[model samples]
Target: MPTTPRIADERHRYILEMLQEHGSCKVAELARTLAVSEMTIHRDLAHLARQNLLRKVHGGAVLRNYIELTFQDRAVQNHEAKVAVAQRAQSLVRPGTSLYLSPGSTTHEFALALIQDDLQIYTNSLPTATALARSAPQGLRVTLLGGELVVFVEALVGPATEAALADLRLTHAFIAVTGVSLEGGLTLYTEEEARVIRAVIRAARKTVLLTDASKFGQLVGPQVGHLEDVHVIVSDHIPDAYRQRCEQHDVEILLTADLDVMPTSAPGAAAADRRN
Candidate 1:
């Protein structure tokens, strides 16, 4: 293993270029490719992730998992955790209320978990729209924001979607993110997705976040909003770091394990379904 400022920068460039070409790279593979130890590769990953150049997943770093979207791929990655988070998030919905659900596998499942009727649900996720439409309770209204579908992500983005969000009002906005940190707030793998999420939050009265434990302290492409912008955070587990940050910002955390905690500190009423 070699250590030098120039070498480190070049290695970082190489990793980014590699991800751009191959989508992802394993730690051991990167180590072999760069003629470095796994420790060096891990250090590079940490550096690159902090720079917001890539997403650090278990055992590797990824360019944009969004580019590899598939219900089967996503619906199963953290199936139980996603379901638990979604199930807890479902409490935010009430009949006849409006919601904005951004694109994400968990948000798609959140759509599936909703049983409320006469709800006006707006979204940019193709899968989410379809899921809610097929299983929607009576009187459920689904609005798919019109825009250019992002490649492999099967989600809409661009001006049309942003413009649509500007004209609407929502009771709640439930979005999924690739990362959340005290430094970057909530982030997505791409700036375009981040923009759409920002718009969704802007249109809603309150914001709710849906994610798994892996996203707790992660950093990715770009941020949507800060911790204070979020009213509730629903996750399988809330890391101590995140819990402390949320508490400082007066944000409520709903741990999916028990679904007992509510966003009591937020301006509006705190709510969720109880579990043992």
Candidate 2:
């Protein structure tokens, strides 16, 4: 028999794989097959769902197809670089201030860094909300927008989410994108997500984009906003040519490598250190 912790871990891993292969599965059946309690299976499902790994449905969980990469697949891609970008983005937040967070792995890491501050955060990303809820600093206030839950990306979009955002104002907005083109502007995978991000840009006093070097010069989808709308571009690296292009639009670019020393010794410290 597997130890309790090992069993729990295996069950979670199995559930993720099962969802990937079968699309979805029933809770009761999974529990029976694994020889675990239904309650344990439910808890595991909730944890995976919070990570945006899968979506909980009527009787079980379903694979979120909108994700461009599998959760496990993303765990290894430029992870060190993304963490650095996230750290750089984290320094921008002051304690006791409110901010808006968008969906994406980089932004998700940014959300993790903010968990230790007293902040009022508004976001449509289920993963961001869950991270904040579970690990946020004392006195943190998080508001999740009500809308149609997009299982694939674990983000809230559509008319209802957009409507909810229209009523709120923010001190800063940290947005992540699939690509940032010098000529094409900020692009995303989904138009609906792009629309919500644009709304966030309009609602916030300062807008910062958190992206790694690899995202530069690539065009993914429709434009969400332009360099002109952003107060600063926080990235791990901004090539001289791209820096010049951003400057042309009156956007200030902050490179992670140029920042002062950081307190945390995390792998991405160089990028996170540049925020302030």
Q: Which is the leading candidate under lDDT?
A: 1
Which runs in model 2 stand beyond 4 Å of their true positions?
1-67, 70-75, 260-276
Clashes counted in candidate 1 amount to 0
Question: Mind giving the per-residue lDDT tens digits that candidate 1 earns over 1-276?
Answer: 449999999999999887765445679988998889999999999998887777786677766534534545767788888998899887667877888888888998888888888888899989888888788888888999999878667889988999999999888889888777776567666566777888887778878888999876665555567767878888888878778777776778888767466444643544221100
Clashes of each: 0, 5
* Cα-based TM-score, every candidate: 0.73, 0.67
| lDDT on C-alpha atoms for all candidate structures | 0.78, 0.74
Tens digit of per-residue lDDT, candidate 2, span 1-276: 534777778888998777554455679999899988788788888988898877776567765555465333554678888888888777677887789988888878887876456789998888889989888888999999888777667888989988887887787889988777666678776567777998887677778888889888775544676656676788878877877765555556666786752222332233233322
Worst 10 residues of 1 by lDDT: 267-276
TM-score of 2: 0.67
Q: How accurate is candidate 2 locally (lDDT)?
A: 0.74
> Per-residue lDDT for 21 in model 2?
49
